[model samples]
Target chain A: MNDSMSTRDSLALAELVELQDVSAVAFSGQRLKPGRGSNLQLSVAAGFALTEQALSYKFDLDGSLVDVDENDPLVQLSLSLVVTYVPRNANAENWVGGDHERLKAFGDSFAWPAAYPFVREGVTAILSRLGADAYQLPMLRPSDLL
Target chain B: MRSLYERVTATLKGARAVAAARLRHEVLALLHQAQLASRMTQSDVARELGVRRSAANQVFRGDGNIRTNTLAEYLHAMGFEADLRLVRAGEPRQAALEQRAVRPAFEDWRIRRPQPTTSGVFVTNEGDDRPVLVRWAATGRTESFRVEAEVTTLPAANSFTPLGKRMFTT
Candidate 1:
């Protein structure tokens, strides 16, 4: 993994992170996780569940009202941001290929900045940016959800 | 309120329908032009392709699944190449809208006659500006109209039976 971020790429990533922070503050009124992946999960204080994807954000506010053993809120809103990066090599083999690892690292690094804003500020900033309800919760790691 | 899943499903269905209809229309138009240029009887072409006359008719009617290879063979037999390209969004919608606008007026002027069963001349008037004669066939039909106000020289018709002979002679 080359792991070298150009000045322009670094600045763009920083801006995306800032936007995520602003969104979290505006919506959930609480910051959950500052660094997460696209599969970041949240159990908001407002009884809503939040899940992030690549294309769009989804909100499952209804899950909050249900009484269950885990009692965690359902995902109410999901915010998806478009993140694009070229793989280090085009002809990398399947899962065991070095090129595949490089590509995954590249995507993870680019996605980090956007994930930061969400985690640091929480859902309030996100909902506020979207002119929606507040989301209060801690960020759920991708591994935990899986 | 509709769920997110409903919205995405509807979008996918709408896109698929539009694509299928456009493909059908394009294939029909190409076959129609090829048949007209070839000047071979539909039955003859059907025999050559080892298909029924109704199948040939369906080719013009834009019904039936046409394998790409079969369509290519048909086009090659007619001395034409089959080419397809993606249609941009703007033009198809504009064409559809124009067709819809003209359809009602055309229908109002159309004279409904008994469906013709064989190749023959038919004349009918439903308050038309001129007298029209239509040549009817099971596969397709052609129409010609004569206006009282017009005096123009008509081109002599050429006798072209089989397409292969016509091409080599020309």
Candidate 2:
């Protein structure tokens, strides 16, 4: 990374277009079958693509809770997100094969740090609305995940 | 006190806001495509519209919200027309319909016509192969909710079908 490319600077130049599919579900007691509570699990997956203009990045994050007892379907929630990122002074015309992969790498490795807060806050807000106890999701860095 | 329905509505509105924010760029990209198609420069469009070069550039850069009339005029200058669409999730595109000046004043102009601030359209300039797609899904006890917005274009210089007219046919 160039000295000029810093997290602060990148975020300053990066413009977020949107976040979608922020949803959550909280389990109510008695809904969960005995022993089924031990199998509860959560998972996160993300994908990134360059916008048509090559001027931005669109990152999608999907998070869900699974393995809830059949009776406790309410205990699970699935979310889908669509995010657009525009990097200052980006040239999409020159982005081909290898360059495209590099850009996706950059999106996974850098853009997440900039966009995670919005995702985290959005998830927090929606879950709170559903009467779920306020929970803190683990903070993840691009290096840690990618 | 807000009911659960109201709370869900508020959260959905927030998601809509995010999608709307993204529309700024999508619109700009469409304008850029129009300019390219017409072989005009920013200066040319500005000069024709009698706006400053920076103002024109700003609109194309998605710097800020644009007025409906201003956007219409700008596209007209480029020989294109902007068609705002409110598409439902999983809806199939119907056969092209004839364009009508038939604006139901009460239902459209009075309550829901295009405005300076809210165009009520989301423009995704991606091509057919790799399209920029936005999808929202929310579940409830019995029913789920989903809707999409998109912008389509046609040549303004020629009388053509309006996208809103075609999709919004009640």
Candidate 3:
């Protein structure tokens, strides 16, 4: 949000150290709701924690669709993302739990926003692969996120 | 400390509920995307679905509890064949992302092998201009490599593993 720092500079400061999944969703027996083409119940969750050398974020994009007519239930589709960005700043470790304006700015303006596209991509790809081409990730204004 | 997932689950509770919450977010996101994709106005949806303009507005802005059929109607009005179905996931939220180095080509030099399975590789510098130093825990030996064009090559640093394309620094 500040003019003094560029996104590129913030990214260069926080190198992507580890990006992986912590929560693996099980969709072994997912099915459509009894009412065909019915409405879907969807959700998204975001949270973060500070590690020894990095800032970590987790995003879970989960959806549940039910067949109100069927006795059997459908499986929920959930994608839990875990991304760790290591701040190469020598003083980064010291700022772990303390109030650090620069760190907060880096996350809000650069690191956190940088992680949005992946979630969007996940939403679109999952829907497309499932043959639900009717939907896609919502449009985002550049200023809205950064 | 409890993991981020566990912590979230502790607060939110119920995988089914969490899944539903995410679905709603995607619904809103997709509705927004659809609205933008066709340049279709809220009035257009209201006209097509035979509803008041405010009704359509509430759904798009996520003003309150949105009906599933209402959302479906919005997409349908926009010429999209949207459906609500739960299918097996073929997607993966990528795992354990790490900084990696590209293989360096040198006649008398060797490249640093990225250990995707191994851990405890230490990077000892802050920026690009500074030389990167790596110290192995078992040997306690430090290896220095000058950073060249964003790629750092280690010559005979480990002397055992192949440095794949992924720069695995665990």
Across B1-170, the per-residue lDDT of candidate 1 in tens digits comes to 86553454368676567667777777878887998899877787788788888987777676778878778867766778885444454356556658743122122225644343222232435665322323332322345433222111111112111111000000
- Candidate 3 runs further than 4 Å off: A1-29, A34-41, A64-76, A90-97, A100-106, A142-146, B1-170
Residues A1-146, candidate 2, lDDT per residue (tens digit)?
55335443433333332222222212222222223222323344444444332223323333332243343433344343333432222343433232434444454555555556665665556445554554455677443443
Q: Which candidate is the best by lDDT?
A: 3
* Best-matching candidate per TM-score: 3
Better of 2 and 3 by TM-score: 3
Q: Please list the C-alpha lDDT of all candidates, in the order they appear.
A: 0.39, 0.46, 0.49
Docking class for model 1 is: incorrect
Better of 1 and 3 by lDDT: 3
True contacts kept of each: 0.00, 0.02, 0.00
Model 3 interface CAPRI class: incorrect
RMSD of each candidate relative to the true structure: 34.0, 25.8, 27.4
lDDT of 3 by residue, B1-170 (tens): 87654555565455456555666887898898898998889999899889999988889888877886777778889877564444322111112123343222332224355333223232445554323323222322235433222222122112212111111000
**lDDT (tens digit, per residue) of candidate 3 on A37-63:** 333445555455554543554445567
